[model samples]
Target: MHGRIKGEAAFRRYVARASDELRQANYTVSAVDLIVTPTRTVEEVILSTDGPKGRVDLPIAIVTDRGPGGLVEIRMYFSTWPITGEHAIRPPLLQHDPNVHEKGAVGDYQRALAAGDLAATLAAFEPQATVREPAGGEYTHTGTAELTELYTLFFSNGGGIPLEHCTVPDDGRACALEYNVTQWGRAAMPPEAGVAVYVRGASGKLIAARIYDDSNPPLHRPDPSFAGCVL
Candidate 1:
């Protein structure tokens, strides 16, 4: 129990013990199988168990990481209801990095916008970051400078902007934001409404962002509102 358990056999034994414990408690449970992924960082195991009053079917997925420190994360994905019926359960989003805070991510982006801090805003993103447009479109920024330019252009336009909500799913590596942008200024601003942004990254940085929106077509103007804006 002290040393590291290596290979499938060791893992099976561990699962067997856990299953037996449940059996003793009059719970119907079984150890299915262990899956070792190619990356070696993730090991997923499946468990099929039953609930009380013979009314529930519980299917659980347990994910583990084989690193310097062995760690396991268990999640229950499906469970049977007591009166309604059997249905799939929506698992709550869990963050992988404990250091990341949802408020920090949302606050940083908002602060950067208010201060027009291009460098700071871009700094929050990963080196290769992609931002998807509202109309099933996408744009990838190669460097921090380029990302800053995009941010600058976005705020300079006179538009009614609102950040509805931000959720950090799968522990800080990804975030989903619901927002709306309306109104527009000549030669620079674009009208928008009801936008959804999905951001994913690691190490407290943003790697990718997928945006979905239903709005008017894209407009490209020659003269931007912030003609002399910098930094």
Candidate 2:
């Protein structure tokens, strides 16, 4: 995969290569959901195609930010194992440490996560809020009962999953944060990059949180039945 391309010329070249690769793979992409704000837009996309084994569908998230002049920035989030057929650590995207000082509901959520307090984390979400896990749709946790069970397992490691927030794109309705996972609970690991979109409700609490990371939690166990690569 092309790591990081700078300049319009380089970006165009990378796009050309990607187009060729996808065409050769007979891949087709379709949008699943979209969230728009004054300055930001997040799209949940699904890429499908027939592969050597059979048909496969891969889910991905794309975040875009706009500015007064024109485009500001764009980033894509998805697990590479789906394409490479292997699980490996992702390299950090940001060269330097990030300055993370969030405000509003997102700030509260971040603080709660750092504290690793189950009650506080639950309070950050609406009564019937939903959290979609990174794997896919089947892993979504909904409502208090399900969320309670999810976070209970999450905080069992004794600390919060700390993320070094890199870029936060928000315009009141929702906020998308590009971050690097620095640590999970008491254990630390190599910085792994990921992105998540947090949607806010009328009460300023979270309505939904869609995560796009493959970071293994301390309690995570691999399932042999699941195949990492899709189409």
Highest TM-score, which number?
2
Question: Cα RMSD (Å) per model?
Answer: 16.7, 4.0
The models' CA-based lDDT, in order, is 0.40, 0.73
Backbone-clash count (model 2): 1
Please give, for residues 129-203, the per-residue lDDT of candidate 1 as tens digits: 765432221233455667766665654544312332322233343444323332222332232223233354655
Candidate 1, position 20, lDDT: 83
* Model 1, C-alpha of 80: deviation from truth (Å): 40
Each candidate's number of clashing pairs is 6, 1
Question: Against the hidden true structure, what lDDT does model 2 obtain?
Answer: 0.73
The residue pairs that clash in candidate 1, if any, are 94-170, 94-171, 95-170, 95-171, 96-171, 126-206
Question: Which 10 residues in a row give candidate 2 its minimum summed lDDT?
Answer: 222-231
- Model 2, 81-187: lDDT tens per residue? 45555445667665434665666878888888877878988998999998876655466778999989778777766688777787776767777777888677787
The lDDT leader among the candidates is 2
